[model samples]
Target: MTETGAAGASESPRPRDSATVMLLRSVAEPAGSGFEVYLLRRASSMAFAPGAHAFPGGGVDRRDVELAPGWTGPSPQVWAQRLGVDTATARALVCAAVRETFEESGVLLAGPSTRELVADTRDEAWERDRRALLDRSLSLAELLARRGLVLRSDLLCPWSRWITPRGQPRRFDTRFFAAALPAGQQARDVGGEADRAAWYAPAAALSAWKRGELPMLPPTMISLRQLAEYTAVTEVLAAHRDLTPIEPELDRVDGRERVLLPDGTTHPLR
Candidate 1:
């Protein structure tokens, strides 16, 4: 393996339980409003995708899945059973999503409402945990407990799941979720993982990528394409409200990459 490849292989991004939350909002287009998803540009110091924009997410932790005080969202047992892991892991995945979103974007989904958190910026202490969490000195669950916060599963909705190709040096069995950009909280690239952040309409973003303005992994590209199809955030959430987890397989064809869903449909990578 090349040095870069070797480093990527050891990059601690192994297929540990994880989840990504795609915070979206509706913006009025000149003609009508449509869905706009948020993306973050990784800080140049990062090992992977040093300058690429991505959704908020990271590796799951043991405390994330602890059921002692798990939030009511998806069934932990069901998710664990589906992902072929223990119940605890499933909960951790959800917790990771909530935690990652907050730490990376400086947005809190834990409050009663988005506006509330924005109204009261006194909870900046949670920001300290962002560095500590990545540094492995603290877990998200502990952070929330210390802050008297709860994981607002109700704000999150299931979207899709994707696993890295089996032969890749770094792999992730990632769950993607969709959540409304909370009203009061603003998304910022606070965590060092990302240096900058912005929101974009899926179609507009993909168009720019096509023109070489941005680069996206196959899964994220396709996910954005799918997201661009809806005109309203509510419609998109209603459509996926009862999502049946469908993981796609990646294949190389015609000197290009393709995303092959288990259902037999295939889409070309942009």
Candidate 2:
């Protein structure tokens, strides 16, 4: 653990539980990769990782644990086993993943039934509901119940978990999830915390990061590298993942501090 503040306390703050989704789509154009990932550039005014490109996600809402919406696919017990958490916490995390994806990306992983998905959410009513969700006026459960929809838990695949390194004021124990862009739905720039949203091939994103164009945190960079290995969205969803928690450590390298990943890679602290 790293010491912080003027008093130099070694205790790190407890990380807030958060969720992020790597929304992927298959592209017809052959470039660096056949699939592209959805990314949002966080608003420069934001407090944490401002101006950095990240996925569609946010901290889990407390209401998420209190409300039980219509659900499909794997049960909460199954998700608890997959996420290595309690049943209620697992349920909230999964709900938060879907909710944040919808709140940030204008993409909803919900449908009327297990066999069907909401095709288009571009209507004015949908926009109102999205805004409501963002403002905390509408809970995911309430919105789904009103719209007669069920959260498609099967659509999401747990990819990885990352904890913010000590020394950062804002810390998040974020679980990364991957889901395919459902058919008939499009991801638009639903601006809020993000100023811009776009799709980039995993290799292209990594190259841009190397060029210092697309600034990202270690988790995003590592996830992009993993995504670069797959040529199709189905491949990513089908791939087995080791969901071990990766908490980067702050280490002194050549007298300057650097963030060290579990794989022995070091990145300069931003």
Candidate 3:
């Protein structure tokens, strides 16, 4: 496998733990049309995957696992089993997914109680807290405690794990999770690292990618490819998935850089 950097000179960077959320929702479109998935385009000035369409996520913060907010659904121990990690790490990963999703997309996978979800987060106070969460002034557990809310951990389904190719300036060992867009909640352009945010039917997004309009990393495209197969959010959430970790192998075939995987898949470098 090719271990040379993109420039064929630099050494590989160590991968950092991160988590991403695939927010899905059903559209009025017909069957086989597939469900919609939210995506954000990173600002061009960013250091990693700039200008690439991606899901909302980021590196795990040490404080993420410290939150003791009320939680419903599967416990951290259960997540550890599903994510193939220890309980502490699993707790952090799940919290990171929820926190990053809210920070980037303004969608909260939380509620006042397990039976209901927060309908609107457009209040000035909510924005203040969101910013505090992003700026590290507040931990999610602390924020939830102040609001008497609980994280609806049941909303998330562990989907996949993807490690960035070995030779890159920035690499992430990212866990991908899927969640249905909460009812009464809508996504908006929150603008930070990402300049634009929108939702697209999975098939449409794939078509855009093929047309060279929606550029994305291999993992994003692969996740979309999988999502394009399902017609509804329920279908995706209910389907059994193999959550094995996948760290794409880099190789130079016929003098062209490519990403190879054990599943007999290959994607040429852009």
Candidate 4:
């Protein structure tokens, strides 16, 4: 462990459980591009991943749990098996994924029943609920129950997991999820922690990162690389994935700071 903060002072990393959603949609333009993934640039004033392009996510809320009301689709047991976590944790992750996706982006992955999905969430009432959720004054379970809706857990696909390296002031054990944008719904910049939000083709985002035009954390970069491989949203959701968690290691190589990935590749720290 580096045992030092970004300022070289000894600091212990406190990793929080988080869930991120990769929202994908099919686009007709740009001939070869099949899909676009939503990306949000965190406000520079934010405490974590400032100014970095990332997926919609945040730490799991205390109220996010298996006891949530009106959950439909795969059971928590199935989610537990897929995420390789306890049933309770699996439930929370799923709830967090749905809640955060709605909070960060205006798209809601829920409906009045299992066979249906909420098509639009742009109304003022929806915005009030979103704000209440963000402020922690409202719980997902309560919102769903009040609205007579069910969480559409079937919409989420488990993709990957990554743990922030130790020694950083803040760290996240974030589970990545992929979901196709619901029909009749559009993602709008709900601007809070993020300065801007937009959809970009996976390859184009990677190119921007490479050119230093956009900053991306390793996990974001890796996830984008993975998404770039598929031509359609169905291909991504249909692909099999290994949910093994990844924790990069920091080491000194020839007196240079470097991060060693699980695949044994090393990326020099900037």
Which candidate gets the maximum TM-score versus the true structure? 2
Candidate 3 — which residues are off by over 4 angstroms? Answer: 1-11, 31-34, 253-256
- Candidate 2 Cα deviation (angstroms), residue 114: 0.3
For model 2, residues 149-225, the per-residue Cα lDDT tens digits are 99999999999999988766778999999999999999999988999999999999999999999999878988999
Q: Please rank every candidate by TM-score, starting with the best.
A: 2, 3, 4, 1
Which pairs clash (backbone N, Cα, C closer than 3 Å) in model 1?
64-92, 65-92, 114-184, 115-184
C-alpha local distance difference test of each model: 0.68, 0.91, 0.87, 0.88
Error of 3 at 25 (Å): 1.3
Candidate 3 lDDT tens digits, 1-270:
444335532477888889999999888767456578999999999999889999999999889866666777799899899999999898889889999999998899999887989998988899999999999999988988898888888999889999987767788999999999999888888999999999998888988999999989889999999998888899899877888889877768667777787786787653
RMSD (Å) of each candidate, 1 decimal: 5.2, 2.4, 2.4, 2.9
Top model number, lDDT: 2
Q: Candidate 1's error at 36, in angstroms?
A: 1.6
Candidate 3, clashing residue pairs?
A: none
Estimate the lDDT of model 4: 0.88
Candidate 1's displacement at residue 121, Å, is 5.0
* Residue runs of model 2 more than 4 Å from their true location after superposition: 1-9, 252-257
Better of 1 and 2 by lDDT: 2
